[model samples]
Target: MTEAPGQITAETPPRLVVLISGRGSNLGALIEACEQGQIPARIVGVVSNRPDAGGLGFAEQHGIPSQVLNHRDYPTREAFDADLATAIEGYAPDWVILAGFMRILTPGFVDRFTGRMLNIHPSLLPKYRGLDTHARALADGETEHGASVHFVTPELDGGPVIMQARVPIVSDDTADTLAARVQRAEHRLYPEVVRRVCSGEIQWSGRILQADGTPLGAPLQLDEDTHNASPPQPAG
Candidate 1:
């Protein structure tokens, strides 16, 4: 039998196996970060549940190996996650990055990679945990919105946040507009978080700790708004 392409050997930089379910914009950011040495690790493989996922193309474009494991083929969610775990572990990844992987993972799967999986969510988290985050934020008349990088836990987006990039809400923003702006922030925020983890500036020792050995306080912020979508909204 042919071995998978992502098997980690004794000698290699930290390996990452990224999971995506849609356009690979964030995956592209990660790939760029790895290739440019901004991140000291490498993405050994990209896996998606949807074969049609556009991110798969990004993986192919970069010569990185890609695989698709359709959930529809499995009778139960647990079974799918089981096989998914097998495939991911096959790579021997140091980290599993969920860029836009849209699945509620089983507790068993979460336990298998505890402290080693990271996910980037669209909403600030503790704000909008599931779908329709952009529209919901606009409906609530919120002034700020952005993305968050967090450790993946069983509670669906309830995991502890590690960092966030806050963007000023543009007055003219529709859901699409807001989502686009936030995604740009994600491109920046996610890579920085991974870079920190890979470089040991951030470590997970039963809990997240900073380079100074201080517990990560309030999730590091990239909150400085270098660009205003509209004239900035006044602080509430």
Candidate 2:
């Protein structure tokens, strides 16, 4: 069962299971953070949907156990998810981190973990919920674009956002350029959020909150240039 908000701490550091697709930069960030004692947790396992994902090599290099559950091999989404859940459960993880997992999980799979899972998206949430977020923002000529970390709900990227790091859209920025900058922000932003969650500084009790047991009025913020996180802001 998912632990209640504030249940995780340094005494009982969360056993983190990270899911990744593609490059898995966020996974690498988490790994570094764990090794450096930045987060009160250890990554127990890493899962990837594609066997060739570069993240798999990272996992192996770190001596962390990893599995690849090719979604195409499964007959249905639910079947794939059921097996995925089993693979994750084997590690007895206290938290599931979707570093770059690309699949749209089934509701059953999503609900299984409930409050114990998190994901980082490319764009600040409630604005860009789906793919190509950088391109979309550029198309709209938005002045600001960034990344967000949110609880994993079945509604794709429509989950409750917990934190964000905003970077200004430069006049000459291409989608690739913007993505590169945002990813750097993510390396900073994702690890810090995980540190907070594992340290019991942030938790989800129906809604996200601080260790003081107050609601997080607004998503946590990070400085664009320094990537330094600001204190928790009041909810509007």
Candidate 3:
């Protein structure tokens, strides 16, 4: 199983170390894709700040190594992130992904990884850059909402945008419903973004991101109903 001679290889598919803190549905998506020979990366390990995170179970079930560094066990955020970096670095991952990981990273740690780390946020980004993005978008009367894949920087959700898939803000959409829809897009978008990252199809240089052979352009505008004219039901 040899991958193309790019950023990743079959023997080493840009070893990924995922960080998760909850249901890990996105983590599960990544694992499933890897098992099915979809993405050009492999999960070297999974890390969580909470031991009870259900994603840890998913990783263990798939035989992917996992670790927990309880934030409560540390005295300060910097100390905890330092330990987290140490543990994740132990696996020598080419990239680190935040899959539902709910911790604000320190500039020092983010600087360490720079363009090698990424995160998935459930909003169009630059629109809603912080927590509760789903509810925030709806409350703001946004016409469309979606997920963003971006380089993880020191600023909260302020990294260079990579890819996004839009979902309509229907008349009856609620935070929960919109969130579910966004998650579905996330499952597809995150893996594609990871593949691009690992294959070198996408590159982050300075403050811009490019795909294939050229610049991807500024904040992408997306169609609310991409596959179907009618709004798709939220994932149950």
Candidate 4:
């Protein structure tokens, strides 16, 4: 099993290596959190599978090191993962964060980070595990939908969820509308989860997840009103 990131302290914040494939809105949130001292962590670098990912520019603007290892250049997933892992390990990251990173990682890559990796899924998870979550949720007439932040495991999005924020499904809500709300929730939820992880308030021992040393059989749900506020802060 991979070791957890070193406990964060005021003098030594946790180091994060974020991976992105697109706009990286979640990445933006994390950057803001670190800058504002909301989380005791530093985003050491940002890596993207696409050379033209917009997140790379955002990283550069903030003076954060950024790298691109285009997936198309590699012949196989394992090959790409090998190179990717090498690039990430070079930074000596305390945590590997997938913020909209659009690649299905190989087991080798997943195992390298194991307990020290995290991802934000746009859905409530264990519901629409794959994609098109907004459309699916709306079509099913679900009354509630939102986002989840979970540990990264080899079973795709099957990892245990740490925290979730729910949005009420309104009448005549389209996929696009619902997705916008969910994205807003994600920006708030993901950073709080990262904060908790870095503070050692939440952790995974083997496959079980715990918060404040108490086992959490299910993901902790956040009150949408309070948790979805601007510039998320640590939950008490």
Better of 1 and 4 by TM-score: 4
Order of models, best TM-score first: 2, 4, 3, 1
lDDT of 1 by residue, 1-236 (tens): 22222223335667889999999899999999999987778898999999899999999999998899999999999999999999998877888999999888999999988877999999887999899999999999999998988888888998877778888888899999999999999988988888877665666654554433556556677745542122212222
The candidates, ranked best first by lDDT, are 4, 2, 1, 3
Q: Could you give candidate 3's per-residue lDDT for residues 1-236 as a string of tens digits?
A: 33432377556677888999999999999998877877877898999999899999999899999999999999999999999999988988888899999999999999998888989998887888888898999899999999988899898999988777788889899999999999988888787777777889777775556666567665343344452122222222
What's the lDDT for all of these models?
Answer: 0.83, 0.87, 0.82, 0.87
Off by over 4 Å in 1: 1-11, 208-211, 223-236
Candidate 2 off by > 4 Å: 1-11, 207-211, 225-227
What are the candidates' C-alpha RMSDs?
6.1, 2.0, 5.9, 4.0
Best by lDDT: 4
Q: What TM-score would each prediction reach against the true structure?
A: 0.89, 0.94, 0.89, 0.93
Which residue pairs collide in model 2, if any? Answer: 217-235
Residue 151 alpha-carbon offset, candidate 3, angstroms: 0.1
Residue 159, candidate 3: alpha-carbon lDDT: 91
